[model samples]
Target: MTPPDLAQRLAVRERPPGRPVMKQRWSRLLFLHWRVDPDLLRPLLPPGLHLDLHEGAAWLGVVPFRMERVRPVLLPAVPGLSWFLELNVRIYCHDDHGRPGVWFLSLDCNQPVAVELARNLFLLPYQHARMRYGGELAATRYHCMRHGEEAEAVYEYGPAPSAEVRNAEPGSLEFFLLERYLLFSQGRGGKLYSGQVNHTPYPWVPADCGKWSTLPVKWDGLPEPQGAPESALWVDHVDVHIFPLRRLE
Candidate 1:
């Protein structure tokens, strides 16, 4: 299969032909990624997808963020249902057609309705979790414990004082990891499906994440990650437009 070219990467950012199905605000995102052995992840991917590598290495990401204003198009945000926290364990991947996207192993969310809706509507791996978020801009704390789990994933992070805010360079590893706009999921009968999300390019900075956990990755049935994460970035916020899921075979 051909590799995803810059043009293809840019193409996914273009608005789809129809109206967006939902609008959401993703804020206070902390991205923690580790380099994983490709052999370990290959067996976990659904059929038709290959691991998307950067410099011959496979990457896994653990992202914890706040979700706000999550409402259907033309609908107002419901006070309780629209606000929540989520933490996802994902890997970079590309379909046989060479379209890059994220393949989630597990998505832990605090809102029960959102979990059910995403599982049924988008075919994602959404799990109900007890989560909490708090703290000021300079310092933040996030915690999540999926139902039936004996331990919780906790994160305490803040901005890296010397790091600067900027968009990732086009051909850099940062761009490869943060620029994904598509996602792949397995629906009923193990059929494949794809969904697209459009948002401004994320402006990221190094994170002073003194506390991070690898439980989410282990919870997904992968080998436990050792040592500190190779990369950690922070994004204050971004408004996103979510499109409908499409059948991919």
Candidate 2:
């Protein structure tokens, strides 16, 4: 299948009509990515999604962030239930229709209720975990251990020097990694689904990270990443609207 034009892919900024199914805020986020062989990832994606690549290389990301203000569209946010830490191991993919999105191998969160809702409602791979966060604005530390599993991730990150926050340029690696607007998942019997999300363009900043591990990726069956990550980025925050999932025909 022909890939979507770069302009078409990046033009997805408008929110869907009617009310969103859920609302949330993602803040204090760090994105760590490694370039991997496309062939190694191709077999892992569900049907209808081809591995999305940039400059002839496929990429995988491990992202840690805080989720806040999580609630239904018209409902009040529940105090304790609405906030938590999340870490996900994901890869970039685009369907035959040329829609770019994230394909998660696993999404670990401290909130068990959120994990259950995501797994059952959206058919996502959501796992419960024991997690914690610390540090100031200059540096942040995050840790997570998946419930009933040996897999975990621990890392510290901060903004890089001169970490100017701005929109990523077209055709750049940062654009490829940060501009995705849809999420693809597979349900029972291999039925594919896609959920749309709308948020303003990320004010991305270069990031510096230390004391990191690739346990999540390795636990997902990929080989451990070697050496340093190809890219490390930080985004302060973004208010997100999540639409209901729709079955892909």
Candidate 3:
């Protein structure tokens, strides 16, 4: 396995050749992450993946965002099916090929069609949820309750007062968390697949997160995190281009 070095991290940001298969706009993204022991995360990964750590500490994130204009390249966005709210529980990981990416434990989306499509077509673990998002960028609120789960995940967040919007600097903790371009998923027979997405580096600011829940992380069977997130970042918007998944060699 290759180490996730600086060059490898930067290399994935390049747009791949060929046409993208889908397009999306992700907005009002709030990323809340906590540093955790790598050992706690190791057993949760599939056989081929290794925890992709920063400073020897694994990171887990609970991200809440709004997805708009999501549709296949050749199709127009359908009004009802296209837009939705999503909250995902994820861990940073790298495959044997040294590709750093997200490994989602559970992705909770409001649209049932989207949940089915993602689970069937992309092999991503998408769960159905009742969700709502409202308020302005400066002060937003999001809530999610996955099907069959008793507790809800709620978040109230916005840009930190007077914080400047900028890209994450290389080798910084922010870069390690927000600059990912690839995602790994497990398909049938325990085989792994990878997909890519290309977008300009996030223009983000430190977030003033309030009243957030650790229930999403607990729902995934992980131990609950104590205290507030070690890092919280927010971005108002980004246009994303998604490529098809390819099986790993």
Candidate 4:
């Protein structure tokens, strides 16, 4: 199997044009987690990766409204008892041409079920992804996370190919822009949001990132896929509406 070539793939080379200089053409990630699973935990986290899901209970992230303005939304900072948040992250190495390389999931908790879902999200044996010159690149839906704080997840995914499982398909996915809308009660914060699928441009991202936003949703009904086992399972998705979405202007 093509074990992820972290060294070769992540090695930073001179910035190529059309891509960001030093760091460019990548996606920004922001996930919130409280309790975590053993298998789904990272040794360390990257900085500048934080979300405030306290004040405004937004559906997705800071959904930009005007152009450079965005509203404030609170993130679930409470641990245990009734707080669960997860978001699988994907940052691309944008290029004038060809495909980008990136993948990850972020969420709260470190439960066994959550770990399993995260594992399945990014990992795909051998399926080394290779994108043609011109074609769709993103995926359809985000990782459907189940269980946790008992909240429904409503999220979406842009068309972007990964190095492993769930790569590009036949047709191209399309995204919409909700520059002006309502989020919970934060009121139209005079910001803007442009949704793009399959064709979302890549921004600049750091390779050796300290903190990340990718996380996974676990199964509460099933007894930790390890020591014991059961049936029932809960699923989740990228609920951008839950959190406030803002453009990185």
**Alpha-carbon local distance difference test for all models:** 0.92, 0.88, 0.92, 0.22
| Model 3: per-residue Cα lDDT over 1-249, one tens digit each | 656999889999999888999999999999999999888998989998888989878899999999999999989999999999999999999888788999999999999999999998789999999999988878899999999998888899999999999999999999999999999999999999989999999999999998799998888888999999999999989999999998988
| Pairs of colliding residues, candidate 1 | none
Whole-structure CA lDDT of model 2: 0.88
Worst 10 residues of 1 by lDDT: 1-10
Query: What is residue 219's positional error in candidate 3, in angstroms?
Result: 0.8
Judge candidate 3 at residue 32 and give its lDDT: 94
The C-alpha stretches of model 1 lying farther than 4 A from their native spots are none
Candidate 1 lDDT over residue span 38-105, tens digit each: 99888888788888888889999999999999999999999999999999999988898889999999
Question: lDDT for model 4, on a 0 to 1 scale?
Answer: 0.22
Quote the positional error of residue 137 for candidate 4 in Å.
8.6
Angstrom error of the Cα, residue 204, model 1: value is 0.7
Error of 3 at 175 (Å): 0.4
Candidate ranking (TM-score, best to worst): 3, 1, 2, 4
Model 3 spans with C-alpha error above 4 angstroms:
none
> What TM-score, over all chains together, does every model reach?
0.98, 0.96, 0.98, 0.18
Candidate 2 lDDT tens digits, 1-249: 666669757765567676789999999899999999889899999779988888789999999999999999989899999999999999999888888889999998999899999999999999889999999866899999988767567889888877677998978889999998889999889989999999999898988887677888876778989988989999989999999998887
